[model samples]
Every structure is written in structure tokens, then in C-alpha cells.
Target: MEYFGPNGDMYLATKKLKRIAIVLKPQESPAEFEIHFKRPDADEIMIKTEKDAELPHNAAIFHSAKTLVESVRVNDNPKKKRLVEDYTHINDQISTNETAIQDTLAYVNLTADIDKAGTTEHLNQIKELTVSINKEKRRRDSVLAAMIAHDWVGKREELDDLLQSDIQIQTPSTSHEQLMAMYDKLKQKGDQVAVLQSKLQNQLSWVSAEDTSRDDTFQELEKLADQLKDELDVLSVLENQRQSVCVGFLRSNKGVHKMLVELL
Candidate 1:
């Protein structure tokens, strides 16, 4: 064996060995030792070493290539084995659940754009998918909760409650079909208002730019007034529809405010 100090400098002296005793030699300056077999037929090996040249306590000991082979009894505790197997199974299940959660989240993100521009049928599918995703998230949390409870005895109840809380998020009272129908109508009315406003602006520009007759000017003013009236009527209906959509969502869940604003 080669010796090393705490600073990792190698010592000049070295020794070669095969098998070593399980027990360490008792302390002695310039220590003398012998390696021997208990059997009468086996030979003994003698070792002489100086204490000053001892390796550091943390240094690793390596055996020679020709070391004697020995059999050792292994621990076979049934309870410990079962516990290890159970822990492995639980970890595998947790890994599977995590993968499922990742897949569900990916689907949710993928459908986000679709949710914005989807037809009523597609939107309905998205709504169902979201509901299913939430349920899967809850299930994942429950499994994690169970694992936490198994590991921590005193905080089981607290962890369980945190994971499986009774809080329920409300959904819009308006049915998907009704809400989409209203949205379509509101969009049509908004387009009409835009058209009327544009027409009124053109009429105003014409009246100001042209040197028209007084009767013609009066006729242009009347047409402007009619356009304004039509725009206002459409706007009033649009506002009512917007209010209905907003109230429908606000009454259900404040969390949906951003979504409603984006949709509008």
C-alpha cells in the first residue's frame, strides 16, 4: 500500500498485499504485523511498517489482484425488502402521474388558440377538455397528498386538505349554445355600427368639401342624422349584449374576467 498525508503527498515507502484482515492492527510505533489463515494448511504473511509513514485516515485501501476469495453472509430482512419494493412502486406511480399531468397541460396550451377562434362545436369540446384536465390535476394532487401523508405522520390531515380542498370554481350560467348565439348577434351589430359610422364620416366630408345647393346640403345633413341614429341603435344593442356576457361570467367566476375581456 502507498501512504499519503492530509495534503495528499505520496510517501516514499510502499507495500504490496493480497487479502487483508478485517480487523486493524493494534497501534505500535514501527508497527509489525502478520497476515495468516485460521486453517493449519494455509501460509502466514508478515508485514513490517513504520507508524510515521501511515496513510491518512480518509485514504482508500486497495487490495492486490491475487487476493483470496471469501463468502459473506448477506442481510435478508423481509420487512426492509418489502419497504424498498413498496417505495419503488410508489415512485414509479408518481412518475407516471407526473407524465400524465405534463401531457394534460400540453393539451391545454395547444387548445388555447383554438378556444379563442373556435366555432361553437369546437369551443364546447375545449370546455369539456378543460374540465377533464382539472379533474386529472386533482387526481395527481391526491396521489401526491397520499405520498406526503405516508412520509409525514403528523401533517397528514393538513396535507390531505390542502391537496383535496372542497373549493369549487363556478362555471358560467349561460349555456355554450346560447352564449355563442348572443356573441354572433353582437358581432353583427358591431359591424353594422362601424359601417354606419364610416358612411356618416364620408357624408360629413362631402358636405364640407362640396359647394352644394342648400337643399342638397339639407338632404346630406338628414342622411348624416339617420346614420348616427342607426349607429346609436346598433351600439345600444351591442352594449346590452356585452353587459349580459360580462354579468354571466362575473356571477359565475371572477377568474374568467380576463377571458371575457379577450373574447369581447
Candidate 2:
């Protein structure tokens, strides 16, 4: 007699009346079976077999099914695990970059304040402050580059714009009085910028240290980006204010030059 096992493999047994049992495992008892046969033709017979086949058959079927099921489960889980690990690593990188950016911003703002205050002092102090501001600006640029590499598009753009405006403000011109006035306003702006930058740095440090998930880092970065944008707007206003003052000073100086020329 031939029978299909749970594994879908075929097994054959002799039709003798001797003991025939199917033992699935060495620790389990062999299930007994009663076989009835009726000769249908000269060379063919119909055989019906009975036993406690349901329990063993189900167990064998479950075992076979478990192999395939476990295999599929094992194959599927690793991709999810890898994805989770990748996400975690990316989050940690972002947090680290955010902290660096904030630190740079704080230093930039502090230097800007010093630039403003020092500009109101003697010529030597102003020159020293300019050098300090340039150094801080370069450091800030490096941080902006890192932020860009980390996919912080908005902040990178904002910092770039601020640096450009600072360069324009620092350009040499002959309107000492106008420069002084703009310098005063710049000092106030610098103080505000410094405070904001410091606050952002503190927040970023706190978030990086305490946050386990990337979501918090993302949120904090977004907030910092927005604040930076607003500060850039203020810088634009400062630029416009300085240009107006400088133009007025130039016009007055031109008038004085024309008066002297006519007098001569």
C-alpha cells in the first residue's frame, strides 16, 4: 500500500497482516492501523485503512506547515530589523549635526555682538572685532556646510544669506557717521541674534541628549530653521537701513564738494 505523508512524500508498505505502524518520532508511540481489503479484479484490490490517524496526521501536517511558516517569518523579519537599525542610525547622525549647527550659531551670534560693540570703540578695537567676526563667520559657514550635508536645506540657505548680508555690511565705505548709526542698530540686532542663537543651542543640546527618537530632533531642527529665517529677515532690514543711510551721507558729501568747488 502507498500513502502520502504530511511532507507530500510517498511511502510504501507491504499488505501482510503483520504489525504495521507509522512512527513519526522515537519518543512517541507508534499508531496502530486496521486495514480492510476487497479484491475488485484479478490484479487490483481496494484497501481502506483506519486508526487514530486524525491526531498524528494533524500533528505531522502542523509540523510540516510550521517549517514553511517559520522559514517565511525568518526571511521577512530581518528586513524590518535592518530598516529599524538604519532609521536609528540616521536619527543619531541628525541629532549630532543639529548640536554642531547650534553650537556654531551661538558662536556666530556672540561674535556678531562683539563686532557691534567693538565697532563703537577705538579704531584698533574695531579692526580686531572685524577679524574675530570673520573667523566666526568662517566657522559658521563650515557648520552650514555640515547642516547641508545632513539635509538641513532651510537652515543652510538661511545661514548662507546671513553671511552674505554680513559681508555686504562690512564692505569699506567713506560714510563714517552713517556707518556708526548702522553700527549701533547692528549692535542691537547682534544682541538679539546672540540671545536667539544661544537659546537654540541650549535647546538642541538638550534634545540631542534626552531624545531617543528622531522625531524630537526633527522638530527641534525645524524650529531652529524657522528662527534662523526670521533672523535673516532682520538682517535684510539692517542692510536696507544701512544702504539708505549711506546714500544720504554720500548725497550730503557730494553737496559739500560741489559748494567747495564753486567757492574755489
| Leading candidate by lDDT | 2
Query: lDDT tens digits, residues 43-112, model 2?
Result: 4322223333334443443343333223321113354334334433444454455555556556556676
Point out where model 1 deviates above 4 Å: 1-173, 209-212, 254-264
What is the clash count of model 1?
1
Q: Please, what are the lDDT tens digits per residue for candidate 1 over residues 4-102? A: 321233333223433222222346321322222231322432332433223321011111100100111112345433433443454455456556656
lDDT of 2 at 12: 35
Overall local distance difference test of candidate 2: 0.43
Instruction: For candidate 2, report its TM-score.
Output: 0.26
Q: Tell me how far candidate 2 lies from the true structure as C-alpha RMSD in angstroms.
A: 25.0
lDDT of 2 at 94: 45
